[model samples]
Target: MIVLGVESSCDETGLALYDTQHGLLSHALYSQVAMHEEYGGVVPELASRDHIRRAIPLLQQALADAKLAPQDIDAIAYTQGPGLAGALLVGSSVACSLGLALDKPVLGIHHLEGHLLSPLLAKEPPEFPFIALLVSGGHTQLMRVDGVGQYTLLGETLDDAAGEAFDKSAKLLGLGYPGGPAISRLAEFGDPLAYKLPRPMLHSKDFNFSFSGLKTAVLTVVKNHEEKVIANICEQDKANIARGFVDAIVDVLTAKCVNALKHTGLKRLVIAGGVGANSQLRASLNEAAAKKRFKVYYPELEFCTDNGAMIAFAGAMRLQINPDAAQRDYSFNVRPRWPLDEIKVV
Candidate 1:
């Protein structure tokens, strides 16, 4: 089956064509990071407008890359929620309109589910009944995955997900927007022992996570550095603080993931979402996996963020499992706050 996926959940406008027989045929993504960078964060209005401008051209590019006509697509899938409402509407409307035009089936996919299932797109995918860590800018969750749509929530952030903490702390250190990458890069020059930061709830009996306290700790450090403003802080201090913050987050995350795995007795660990792209986190997980004699899986870097490919791949997988999952209903609604575990299998 040929499925076209549209993703406009937030700052990215993505389109892709996925062939069940051939895997991902083609995918295109247009990021609004450059535009949003000027504002130090995303403006929903601007994000929505950019999606309007980029989605169609991206779709055409994806189709052209795949060498497929619109009519050749068997189904249309779109991220239905857990994003900006206006942005979600753009993708959903486009997808539904396309489905109507082609008389093809349409499916509304949960955004988080797309990220959770993205690892299957990797060359060496984890099998069923694995542990999954979905860490991104908007969310941080650990789940026990028995199979597609069979997810048991292990735990999630109480407040401020890991990615948010990273960005917030980076801003405190004078880093610009989308602070995760900037902080990670700066941490490379940092001395691991330069400062000690708190690891919030690292020893909690449950698998739950909390990064809010850690971010606050970073703020306290910045204040005590004798700098009246971020500009007054020296570069070395920034790198050192970034390292401390990164280490603390990595430690807590790694500990919780290990605890979740041991609790579930699942050896296969799958990391998805943007924070899963962190080099330090990957290194920590890799070392732990080797020591624990388990396996770890990740999506290709391109699939780490919001993308149409994961949505399309997820939709295709759903249809493969239950052909009746997709309907001819062109009418659709988006859930800007959908929960992953609420998704019921058809």
Candidate 2:
């Protein structure tokens, strides 16, 4: 079956064509990072409008690049929830309309599920019953995955998401918007011990995490720097601060993941979401995995963020489980919020 997936969950507009036989044929993504950069964060209204403008052309380009027509697409899969309402509406409306016009099945896929299953799209895919660490801009979570559509929430953030903390704190430091990468780069030169930021909930027996305190800790560091009590932070100090912040986050994340593994007895770990792109986090996790001798899997960098290939693959998997779910004569509603465990596939 051929599935066309559309993703407009946040600041990204992605379209992709996936064929079960040949794999992902073509995919396109347009990031609104630059548009939101000046605003220091995403503006919902602008993000929605941009998605409206980019979806169609991107879909057309994806289909053309795949050397197929709309009719060739067997189903349309769109991220249905847990994102900006307007942005989700754009993709949902377009996907449903296209599905109706083409007489193809339309599946409303959960955004987090798309992120969770992304690693499977890579050359090295983890087997069933693995733990997934989903650290994105809006969410930071740990889950036990028995299989597609079978996810058990292990733990999650009680306050700010990891990526959100990164971006917001970076802004406070004048690192600009979408600061994860920039801050991460600067962190490479810094000493993790220089700043000694707090690692919130690192010792929590449960899987739950808390980054709010960590954000406050960053604020305190910056505040002290401004008062001249600590003097102007040198380039090395800035780097060291970055390193400490990143390290604190990574430490908490790693601890929770390790705990989740022990709790679930799952030896394999799959990391997903935008923060999975962090070089430091990846290195830290990789080193831990090596010492623990536990396998770890990561999606290709492009798939690490919101994209359509995972949606397409997920839609394809759902359809394979129940072919009857492929009827698309009528429109379907998009879900802005849904629980991963509530979904049961085959």
Candidate achieving the largest TM-score: 1
Model 1 TM-score relative to the real fold: 0.99
Looking at candidate 1, the ten consecutive residues that score lowest on lDDT are 221-230
C-alpha lDDT values of all predictions: 0.93, 0.87
lDDT of 2 by residue, 233-330 (tens): 67787788888899999998887887788777779999999999998888888988888878889999999989988888888888877777666655
Candidate 2 deviant stretches above 4 angstroms: 226-232
User: Against the true structure, what is each candidate's TM-score?
Assistant: 0.99, 0.96
Cα error of candidate 1 at position 79, Å = 0.3
Error of 1 at 107 (Å): 0.2
lDDT by residue (tens digit), candidate 1, 143-223: 999988999998999999999998999988889999999999999999999999999999999988999999999999888
